[model samples]
Target: MTLKHQPAYIIKMRAKPGQGDRLFELATVGMEKSGASDRFVIAREDEDPDVLWNVEVFRSEEAKDAYENSPLADELRDEIIGLLAEPPMRIPVHPYSALPAAPS
Candidate 1:
């Protein structure tokens, strides 16, 4: 299976005040539990600890849409939104090239 041309998202979230760690924790757990993406990663900004960048690559567009519309996703979204300083920003993209997954 190749991830070439896969749909992905780079979601930028800013946690409220000191909620950065909590936000990252919840987001990570949510991603892990969802099983919605083949590639999931979360990174914190160096300049601003409160800023987080979540990257996800899905197997297909239908899977992505289904995950986004799921009740579990809704619940997680609410929980995550409560910790945010502002609405999360989602940037969708298609992979031009990607390296293979590393050994587990």
Candidate 2:
């Protein structure tokens, strides 16, 4: 059997004080509508309350684009932009696992 691969997106943001909750709320709404396989946030070290990292996985690049262009995502972007101290950083990733060299 062939292995399946999926695209992933990572976003790092530094929210303004007291804005993390609001960002989380906006992301929840957008994620619910994006049809993504998974999404979540990770807190940075150094106890930087404002620093957050979000990771989202999609089945395909088309799905990722659809999610990015969705109205809900647009709204979330707008909301998060207003609450961030600086622009959010984003990275796209494609991950795969080998199948034991196909038994040689």
TM-score of each: 0.91, 0.75
* Winning model by TM-score: 1
Residue 77 of model 1, lDDT score? 91
Model 2: clashing residue pairs? none
lDDT of 2 at 51: 78
RMSD of each: 1.4, 6.0
Candidate 2 overall Cα lDDT vs. reference? 0.70
Off by over 4 Å in 1: none
Candidate 2 lDDT by residue in tens digits, 48-103: 76777776667677777777777777777888899998888989775454334345
- Candidate 1 per-residue lDDT over residues 1-98, each given as its tens digit: 56876789989999999999999998998888888888888999999999999889998888888889998799989999999999989999877787
Q: Which stretches of candidate 2 lie over 4 Å from their true place?
A: 1-4, 38-46, 97-104
lDDT of 1 at 15: 98
